[model samples]
Target: MQETYRRSADSAKGRQRRAELLESVTRDLAEHGLVDFSLRRAARAAGTTHKVLLYYFADGDDLLAQALLRLRGQRVGNALQAVAALPSGTLGDRIRAIWPMLEADATGLRVIDQAIGLAMYDPARYAHLAREAAEQYLAPLTGLLPPEWSSARREEVANLLLATFRGFLMDWRTTSDTTRIESALEALARAMDREAADGP
Candidate 1:
């Protein structure tokens, strides 16, 4: 019994340590961006040794993927909370509420773009992560839509909104032209509102 208890305690401690490492890496990636990320770099960011990171993660890619996913989760969680507090209205209203939150996190967006670029560059290793990232982002956005709409309809709108948002984010990253992007965003929102009003 004592041996089992000791093992359980060790397991709990290990889990907690792993979580701390992950959190540290996620914050580092969010601030520094995910360019040429290596296990040694992650270790330095986490204030731990690479061997320690390997004990908790399979490899550098695995560590990087988890950090990116955590960053994405933080962004999505904040957006959901902010948007939920707002009164339900048109799709345009939701879009307007979400864009500012996303815009403010330019670092987060850039890191995510970098991860997507990894997938494009090395499909054998990173494509699954890109797909996972898409689903993780899409589900919450879809849930925010009106419940009366069919699953098909919600998913369709969610895909379009996600794609549009990604495009605008990429553009913003490239140009830093807030005025142009904001204007385009407003136009997109207005168009979505019109479509929502028309209904299925």
Candidate 2:
């Protein structure tokens, strides 16, 4: 009985440690970017041993992938929920309403930027994560669009939207230009509205 109890306690502790490690990794990637992040550094930042980090994550790539997934899921879920709550209106209104929420998730955006940079050299890893992000994050946004739009058009718009967002975020990180970001989004909203007015 005592052995079983000890085993259960150990399992709980392991779970807690893994969660802490993930949180630390998320913050580190957000703050420092992930160009040269090392697992040993993450372990030390988390106040844990390198072996412990390995126990939870296979390697730095695996840890980064999982961290990106977790951050994407949470932030995208919130953004989609906000978008859903917006009243039925022109696409511009919908897009504008959700911009603030997207802007607030700066950390999530940084994690995504890091993931994309890493994915360039590692197609297999990129494909795996791209699939997950598409299903969980991109699909929801596309689903919110008008049904008359074709699949190809929807895909194009989704890609453009994500690219625009990432570009603006990268600029914002360097320039801290909230006004420019807002103005750019405003232009996008107007353009999207014009496109909708023209109809399919």
Candidate 3:
């Protein structure tokens, strides 16, 4: 009976170890990106073996998805908090305030691009992550609006801003053209002013 109790306790220990492995994996992704991710490499980074990593994650993609999700969550949460910290401003003002803060390091950008690639490659496996990402990024912005706006209206504003931000960021990444991106941001700023002045 005591041995069975010990066995159950061991399961909990296994879970804790798995969580620790995940943290290490996410750290590895943050520092080095996931370009060469494999069961053996990831296991080595986590200070474990391939068989042990397989015990925790079914495959490389599974591990990658989970690690990327964790990384995205941290970034999204920080952006949301930063947006909330700024003084009251037009929706556009708040949007502009957060733009510069969102620029990630080379490794961070790699994580973002690679994660998006993963979703593009297998939407079914990563669709939930993609959805969660949008939701988390959009969630905190709803509070930036005037209290007079309806919940639905606030949500619409968030959706539009989120879409615009992502599009501009993609353009910046693709063209390496900050001049054009800044112009676009100015346009967005004007549009935000108009939206704040004219309801809906």
Candidate 4:
């Protein structure tokens, strides 16, 4: 009985420690970009040794995957909360509603963009992370669509909206041209609103 209790306590402690470490790494990545991340760097950010990080995470990639996913979740969670606070509006309103939140989080967007760039740079290492991030963002947007639409249509629109938003985000980040980005977003919102209304 004592041995079992001891093991259970150890497992609980391990989980808590891992969560703390993950939070530290997430904050670090937010402050410092993920362009040249390494296990040692994460360990340094967490104020622990690389060996300790390995004990909790499989490797640098696994740690990065979790951190990126956490960042994405925070972004989605914030957007959902913002949307919930507003009155139900057109599809265009929803698109417009979410943009300011995304636009405000320069750090979060930078991390996401960096993750995508990393995945593209080395597909073998980071491709799964990028795919998972896409799915995470896609599901919530699909849920926001009208129920009358077919599943296929909702998914298709979700993909196009995400792609468009990502492109505009990159452009905005690179150019810092709010006027051009806002114009593009307005065009997108109009297009989406039309598609949603003219549906099967």
Candidate structures ordered by lDDT, highest first:
4, 1, 3, 2
Which 10 consecutive residues of model 3 have the lowest summed lDDT?
1-10
| Model 1 per-residue lDDT tens digits across residues 43-107 | 99999999878778878888888888887887788778778878667878888888887777755
For candidate 1, the lDDT comes to: 0.82
TM-score list, all predictions: 0.88, 0.71, 0.80, 0.90
The candidate that wins on TM-score is: 4
Stretches > 4 Å off in candidate 2: 1-24, 27-36, 45-47, 105-111, 114-137
What global local distance difference test value does model 3 have?
0.75
As for candidate 2, its clashing pairs are none
The sequence of per-residue lDDT tens digits that candidate 4 reaches over residues 29-117 is: 98888867889899999999998787778788899889988888888887888788787788888888888877777665578777877
lDDT of each: 0.82, 0.74, 0.75, 0.85
Worst 10 residues of 2 by lDDT: 1-10
RMSD vs true structure, all candidates: 3.4, 4.8, 3.6, 3.2
The candidate with the higher lDDT, 2 or 3, is 3
Best by lDDT: 4
Answer with 2 or 4, whichever has the higher lDDT: 4
Q: What TM-score number comes out for model 3?
A: 0.80
Candidate number that wins on lDDT, 1 or 2 = 1
* Candidate 4 backbone collisions, by pair: none
Decide which is better by TM-score, 1 or 4: 4
